[model samples]
Target chain A: MIIRMAFTEFKLYLREPASVAATLGLPLLIVVSFGLLINPGTDTSSLVTYFPGMAIAFSLAILSLNLLPTILANYREKGILRRLSTTPVPPASLLLAQVAVSFAVALAMTLIVVVVGHFVIGFTVPAQLGGFLLAFVLGTLSLFTVGLVIAAIAPSGRAATGIGMLVFFLNMFAGGVFTPRETLPDFLNRIGDFLPLGATLTAMRDAWSGSFPQPLHLLVMATITVVFGLAAAGLFRWE
Target chain B: MAIIEVTNLHKRYRDHVAVHDVSLTVQRGEIFGILGPNGAGKTTTVECVEGLRAPDGGTVRVLGKDPRADRTHLRTKIGVQLQESQLPDRLRVGEALQLYSTFYPDPADWRRLLSDWGLEAKRDTPFGKLSGGQKQRLFIALALIGNPEIAVLDELTTGLDPQARRDTWQLVEEIRERGVTVLLVTHFMAEAERLCDRIAVIDAGRVVAVDTPSGLVSRVDAEQTVRFRPSAPLAEHLLTDLPEVSSVRRVGGQLVVSGTGNLLHAVTSVLARHQVVAADLRVEQADLDDAFVALTGRKLEESK
Candidate 1:
């Protein structure tokens, strides 16, 4: 029943063109933009080479920070959630449906980025294919879990969107989107590496370098997923 | 047997009491109307029974199960349409019906429901694109989609034109004819009088009167208000001399003769005897509106 509800929610989410564009189209557009600006052999290279890294990062961010919150907030604002409380549908089903929708979006984002990066940007994905896939999936879970927290706690739909933007920008900057964390100050590097975004970024960077994470990074990412997921579940309100 | 039993339901919001010691029983296969003015706690009482809101002090049993305690079972058997309910703006009418239908095990045929509610043309249209009457029709369609044993509708015809309102009223009758118990919450006196088998008039969070519509109306201290416009404003004694005239009051160049049956005939007889000509002579029958006003000491529109 829960899975059926989740599938129903995903179908509804996919019907919205704006949700589709934001989750699936925006990341591909970013990759195309990078493809235009970058020359692979140049010393002053563009961020096109970082497409695969940004793929996992962007997918996680969009699912957790962008898509899930808006959907949940809209449900709350329109009294859909309130009505559901009177029905047989479990409250957890709503949260699970949200995660399922984002996960589906992540799959689409990953495929787009991989195809675009390989052909247009002339970038080679990690040589350790198995290791990279494992790291990418774990990183997606971490980011998606963070979005669950936002969806649970946001007071309104507008507030959820605002907070999603704020969290996305902050995490993107500090999680080594522009520059690698190694070149930063030692304290900042230490803090960034432990953060959920920072940890996912490290996993993605390692995957891009054709090496698996040293187990501790994956552990930290897993811990972030569990902690935020629990917090979101505990604080969630059907009304 | 009663399909729904609400006993002394007391709901308070902050310092104000919303439903105060209100109790009513609705039997199966009957249309029971809950009529009240705005701010009269009609919605609160119904929502409590539907398990949407918990009553501070009361017991609500739908199908012999406590509403708040046995919510899942209660929900399966009961259907509800809230007063200010809203669906997603981009949700299509058919989609809303389908989504709600999924919650119930045995739902009505979607095509038949759309045609019954006159929403077939707007099935593919988004909810926000619908006109007010169309939206209301869609709501009614969604409410009946679930093949519920008991359905509660709050302000069913509010915001609808006269024609649309009559259509909805007829739909309510059709629903009852299918053996589904209905609890209609409304403020319109004529609607209650026309559609309800019995009515419970609420005021100030209390059940003021509960009976058949005409029973309550006849019980109130109301007399027929006989109104007539005379060509010449003279001798108030003309109407006052009538045998059945209770009181004569001049309201804006019109003589209002308040009395019981034969008051009109007596007034006309008196006027004819004196050869007085009256224009636009009219007799206003005492109805639920007058009873409501007389019982509450305030008009329905003025209560809130």
Candidate 2:
């Protein structure tokens, strides 16, 4: 049932140029363009290694914060969820559909970033691939769970998008996705250290730079995955 | 046996009362209409029966099981078409039907239902692209996709053209012929009178009357107007003194007698005795609209 729903949802997502462009196209554009500007740098341990993971993180933020919440809230605001509730099947299947599609897109973005970085930018693959995979899974869970909470709180699709956009930029800025490391303030850096996206990005970058992920970062993502995930499940409404 | 039963149903949102002490029973193979003005708790009542809501103070039973408690079980046997619910804009008609078909253990064929509802030509059309009437038809088709024994259709034909309304009414009759009990919520009197086997007239979140359409019309006891031009000048006391007559008025040269029960016979006998011919006579029977007015102290059309 979830597969069928995801197929239809994927169709809808494909037709949405804005969502496709932001979540999928944005990361590839960043990778290819930036990689060309810098050319083939021999410093694989520097930004080149972290950049692939960062691009994947960016895709996760787009999917979990902006795209997922906006679409789910729209379904509720438009009575689509209410309509589904009348059927024998539960409406929670829609959440599953969202998770499935978001993860698939996040994976695709990660593959593109890594492949483009390795072949075009001379970046080596992650030494601790297991740690990288674990971080990716935990990060997806925690981020998507926050997305569910946002979708639940917003009264309508348009409202969800507004809130999603605000949170997305804030998450990115605090996590240092766009800011240079030295230029960021100490207070903002400390604050981002506790956030799921920030913690997950740091853990992923650690694994990608040929080392095991930080246990503290892994613990933060795991705690967020449990807390926000449960809150979202408890607060969700079909209408 | 009654397919649906509601007892003293009450629903409130914050401090505003939406449904207050409303109750009705729908027997098997019956087309029960709930007639009321907008915001009169009609939708709230049906929602309780559909298990979409848990009544604040009442019991709702569908097929001998509580709607809220046995929601999963009731869902297979009962179908619902909500008043304001919609699908995703990009969801195609055929896809909607096909998706709903997977919900029930025993479902109707989507292709057959599409053609039955006159939606075969619109199979590929997206929901947002369909006209008002087409959307209504799709809702009905989706409601029946489960092949439910009971279908709760709330405001099924609202905002449709007269022609489309009539066509939908025919489709509803076909649904009834298949032995599906229907609980319909509507505001149109002509619709209630034409399709409803029995109607529960609701007003101000309360049920004012429950009876057959004609039975409701008879309950009002509102007057029928008899209008005609008297051929010759006559003593006004002869028409005024009749017990069956309520009021005698002169509208431009015509004498109009408004009363109930044999007013026409009394007035005509009086005219015969006085040798005054009743020219251009017309007697209007009090219809459902007048009955609605008498019961609710407001016109149905005016309520909207």
Candidate 3:
């Protein structure tokens, strides 16, 4: 039942052209546009990780912070969840379906970025495969949990979009998506290390450079996932 | 047999009471109505019966199971169309019905429901693109997709045009013909009169009356008036003398006679005896609207 619901949700998500463009197209555009200029194949600098990290961060932020919250809150605002409660199937199944759809979209985009970056853009694949997988899983979980919390508290669809945009921009600026941490002041980088997006980008970059992620970055993402996941579950309203 | 029984149901939100006390039983294979103006707690009452809400006090049983306690089980038996609930804008009509059909153990065929509800042509049309009447038909279709024994439809035609409203009413009758008990909620007097087998008139969070359409009108004072232009001058005492006629007066060239119990028949008979031709005759009888006013001391539309 949940699989059927998730498939339906995925179909609905595809109908929204603007959402598809923002989540999928925008990230690929970032990677290709920057990859052409940086010519990361010949360059030996740490700057090779910069473009791919920014693309991943942007895609994850849009999917988890922007799209996930808006869709869930809109379901609540429009009474779709309320209608589902009257059926034999519980409304929580719809929530799970939504999460499944978002995760599927995120996973698809991640693979596209990695494959295209390695083959087309001439960047090396992450050598520390275990570290890369761990960082990616923890980062996705934490970011999606934050989005769930936003959906739980937002009163309406428009409100969810507003709150999500605010959080997305804040994360982008503070988490080193806008500028590399190498260029930022020491205090900002210190603060960025604790943010979910920041911890994710740093850990992912380390794994791409053939090193295990710092324990501090992994701990920060894990803590956010647990705390925000519990908060969202507790606060969600079906109607 | 009663398919649904809600007894002394009480529900409140914060300091304001939404449903103070509501009690009604819906017999199987009948179209029962909960008619009331806006904010009269009509939706709140049906919500309890639908198992969407847990009443603050009292018991609600549907198919012999407590609504709140046995919600998961009762949900398969009772289908609901909420007042303001909506589907996703991009969800296609066929997909919505097909997806909902999976929720039930014994589901109605989605393809048949598509044709049955006149939505076959709109199979691929997104919900946002459908017209109001089309949207209402889709909602009704979704409500019955589970093959529930009881279908609870709330405010099914509040925003429809007269023609569309009548069309929807016919569809509701079709539902009853299939042996599914219907619980209809609306504020439209004509809708209740035409569609409901029994109606419970709710006012100010309480049920003012519950009876058949004609029974509600008869519960009123049963006063009727007959108006006509007298071809020949007739004595006012002629109408006043009849037991059924309580008062007689003149409006321009017409004489108006008001009374109770066969007042129109008594007035016309008296006119025939006097050999006076009654020109432009019109009889006004109390209807559901009038009964609503008499019971609640306020007009239905005015309460809105």
Candidate 4:
């Protein structure tokens, strides 16, 4: 039943243009544009190499902050969550299904960026495949857990989207979506390492460049996953 | 046997009391109505029975199980059509039915139920696009999709057209014939009189009377009141002394005569004998409507 519900939810997602734009179009456009257009300019890094990480991190921001929270909060505002509570299928199952869908879309979007970066522009695959996978999964859990908290607290569909956008812009800047962390001031770079999107980009990029992520970044990811996951689950109002 | 039993149920919201000591029983295979004006706590009481809300001071049992504690079990057996219910804007009628049907262990085929409710032609329509009558019929179909042993339909025909209302009543009868008990909540006296096997008339959060339609009608005080302005001044006792006149009062030049059994006939004959011409004489039967007023101490319109 949970799987069926998730599949139904996904089918509905296909009909939403804004969701498609945020989850699919934005990330793919970044990867393709950076890989083909811009020059790396000296000994720093190539656009093809640096952009896969940024594009994947950007996809995470869009899915977790924009897509997931808006959809879940809208469902609550619409009484869909309350209606599901009366059934044998627990309401948690519905939340889990939604989270699962969000994660799947984010992962698929990242994979598209990775695939396009790899074959289209002669971009190298992440050298530490296992480390890359671990970072990606943990980062998603942490980010989407925060998304759940936003969904839990937002009162209406419009309020949820507004909050989601607020968080997205704030975190995207921290994640170096517009500016590379290497060029940032020392204190700002240090701050970026602690933020969710920043931690995700740093960890994934490190894994892609042939090493495990920093222990602190991994810890940050795990702590947010556990803490925010529990908080959102506890605070969620079915109505 | 009573499939539903509510005992001394009391529910309050903040300082305002919604259900004040409401107790009613619904027998199996009967159309039971909780008839009352708007905000009379009909919805509150039934919501408790549906396990959607908990009573503040009493217990409600559905199918011999406590509604609150046994909600998971009760949900499968009871269908509820709440007053302000709505579906997701884009959900198609067929898709909504399929999703709900998946919740039950043995759901009726939604295809057949859709046709039964005259909604087969609207299977592909989105809920937000359906007309008021179509939306209502779709909701009825959804409620019966699980083939519940009992269905709670609150204010089911509030926004429906007349033809739709009559059609829905027929559908309720058909559902009853299939042996599913129904709990109907409404304010329409005629609907209650025609459809309910028994009704509990609620007022000010209390069940004022519980009886069959005719039994309630019989409970009405059979005094018919005649109000008119007399053409000439006459002694008030001339109208009050008659055997049929229960009482006579004069207010602002209009004579009010109230009595049981032919008060109008008796009062008019006296006016003629005395040569007291009456102006603007109006006579009306004080039937079940008056009974509601008598019990509640307020006209139904005023109460609403």
Candidate 5:
């Protein structure tokens, strides 16, 4: 049932150019802008070095904070969820559809960013494929779960948009999208490791730089994903 | 067996009681009308029966299954059309029918439904782009897609013009002709009179009266009014001496005389005696509207 709903949702999602632009186009724009701004002449190739972190933040922001809310908002505004409530469709199928679509979008966005950053912008791929894949899967789960929570609670599309923007911006900054956490203030650095966004970003960066993070970072992200996922399922409203 | 049996159903929102101990039975192959104004709990009660809402108290059985407890089974057998429910803006007319049809084991033929609803040209058009009447027709088509034993339609023709409204009414009759029970919710007395085999008149979340449309109309003892456009304005003195005349009032260059049986004959005789040759004389018989007004003590619009 989830697969069937996801297939239909994916088709519906493709028909909306605006959604495609937000999910795919925005991330590409961010990658290009950052790549140009960070002069290659710099000692560490500043922008290229940040590609892995950028990928994590972009996918998380787009999938969890942007795509999830918009879809859920549309469902509420159109009364699609309310109508579905009267059908034999299991209520959980809605949440599964949301997570599946977001996961697919995130995976696609990751591949696009990787291909463009490496082939077009002359960035290098992570040395360890196994580590990168592990980090990517964990980061995807973390973003997907948070997105589910936001969609579960938002009252309307407009409200969801507003809330999604706020969370996405905050996460982008705190999750080490532009600058590494080692450069942040001491107090923020202390709590940052525990933040879902921060933990996922740190893990992704380590995988990209070819150095693995402490296993605890991956565990923290996984635990948060599980807890938040359950909460979202419980709080979800068809209407 | 009755498709739906709603007994002592009550739903309250905050401190306001939206549905107050309302009860009704919709039998097989019958069109049952729930007539009430906005916020009169017509939508709420129907929603409860469709398993879209859970009533605060009392039991609702749709096809002998509890709506809230056995919702999955009940939903497969019942179809619901809320006034405000809509599909995604991107969904096409044909896609909407196909998607809904998948929910039931035995769905009606999709092509026939589209042609019957005059939606063949609009099949590829997005749902958001359809006109008001077109959208309404698509909704009715979707509701019947499952070949449901019972279909619930809320405010079936609230926004259509007279012609479109009549078209929808004809379609509804066709559904009944196919042996499907229909639960129609509306505020329009004319619609109830025209379509319902029996109607339950609801006011302020409770069933105030239930009967055949004419049976309810007869409850008020409403007079059959005779209206005429006099060559000259009717004099108030002409109606003063007639005992059979209940009330006489001049409204907009015409005289409206309201009275009991044989009032038209008596009115004509009185007018002729007074040398009145009215240009346009029309009888305004008591209708379901009169019954609604009498039972509720308020017009539908006023209550809303």
Candidate 6:
């Protein structure tokens, strides 16, 4: 039943062209557009790590910060969750289905970016495969949990979208998506290291450059995941 | 047998009471109505029965189980169509039905429900694109998809046109024909009169009366009025002398006679004896609307 619910949710997600464009099309567009300009072969600088990191970060950010909150809050606002509670199946199944769908989308986008970047853009796969996978999993969980918190508190769909956009931009700036962390000031980089998106990008970059991620970055992501996951579960309202 | 029994149910919010001292019972295989104007606690009462809200006081039992305590088990037996609830805009009709059918252990076939509710052509249509009548039909279809023994529909036709409302009423009747007990909540007098076997008239968070449509009207007053334009001038004493006639008056070439207990028969007999032709005759009796006014001291629409 949960699998069926998730499958239906995925189908509904596909029907929304705007969501598909943002989550899937936008990230691929960013990778291709930036890859053409920066030739990873000749640019031996740390700049090669910037493009793929930004693409993956953007995809995860859109899925977690924007889509997740907006859709879940909309379900509450429209009484879909209330309607589901009347059925024999619990409404939490819908919530789990939503999370599963979001996770699947994030995973699919990550793979697409990695493969397309490596083969088409002349970029290298992360040499430290274990570190890369760890960073990716922790980052996705942390960011998605933050989105769940937003969904739990937001009163309406429009408000959720607004709050999500604000958070997304803040994460983008702090995570070094707008400008490479290498170019940022030392003080700004210190702050960025603690943010979910920033920690993810820095860790992914380190793995891509044949080094394991810093333990501090991994710890920060894990802490955020636990704290925000608990908050979301505690505050969520079925109505 | 009584499938649902709500006794002395009391529920209140922080600042105000939504339902106060309400009680009613719904028998199996009958359409029981909870009729009231807006803010009359009609929805609150039904919500308690559905186990959507926990009553602050009183006991509610459905199919011999406490609604709140046995919610998971009761959910399979009670299908609900909540007021102001909606589906995702992009969810197709067929997909919505198919998805909900999986929620129950024994569900009605989605394909047959599609045809039963006249939604086969709209199976692929998204919820946002359907018309209001079609959307209501879809909601009813979803409610029955679980094959529940009791179906609760709240404000089923509040915003529908007259023709659409009538069509939906027919569909509700068909539901009863399937041996499913129905609990209908509405503020429309005609709707309750036409569909409900018995109605509990709720007012100001309390039940004012509970009886069949005709029974409620009789409770108000059995006054009947017969109006007609006489073909020839008739003597006023002719109707005044009859015991059934309470009063008689003439207004603009028409005789207005108000009385009780077979007043129409008494008046017609008198007219026939006097050889006075009564043209354009009309009879008016107390209806549910009048009963509502008498019971609550306010018209249903006025309270709205």
Candidate numbers, best lDDT first, in rank order: 6, 3, 2, 4, 5, 1
lDDT of predicted model 1? 0.79
Report the number of the highest-DockQ candidate. Answer: 3
Report fnat in order of the candidates.
Answer: 0.47, 0.59, 0.94, 0.37, 0.65, 0.86
Model 2, A11-76: lDDT tens digits are 778878888888888888877777677664645335665466667778889899988998899899
Please give the range of 10 consecutive residues that has the lowest summed lDDT in model 2 chain B. B96-105
Q: What docking class should model 2 receive?
A: medium
lDDT of 4 by residue, B70-89 (tens): 98888888887877667767
> Which is the better candidate, 1 or 3, if ranked by DockQ?
3
| Deviation (Å) of A198 in candidate 3 | 0.7
I-RMSD for candidate 5? 1.5
Instruction: Give the whole-model CA lDDT for all candidates, comma-separated.
Output: 0.79, 0.86, 0.92, 0.84, 0.80, 0.93
> Number of the top candidate by lDDT?
6
Candidate 1 wrongly placed segments (more than 4 Å): A1-8, A32-49, A178-187, A214-216, B13-16, B161-163, B229-243, B249-255, B268-279
Worst 10 residues of 1 chain B by lDDT: B232-241
* CAPRI quality band, candidate 5: medium
Residue-wise lDDT of candidate 6 within B153-221, one digit each (tens)?
999998999999999999999999999999999999999999999999999899999999989999987
lDDT of 5 by residue, B15-106 (tens): 99999989998889999999998888999999899887789999998888898889877777887787888888888898788777776678
Q: Write the per-residue lDDT of candidate 1 for residues B10-34, one digit (tens) a residue.
A: 9999999999989999989999999
What local lDDT does model 4 show for residue A190? Answer: 79
- The TM-score each candidate achieves on chain A is 0.85, 0.94, 0.98, 0.94, 0.86, 0.98
Instruction: Determine the TM-score of chain B of model 2.
Output: 0.92
TM-score of each: 0.88, 0.93, 0.99, 0.86, 0.89, 0.98
Candidate 3 error regions (>4 Å): none
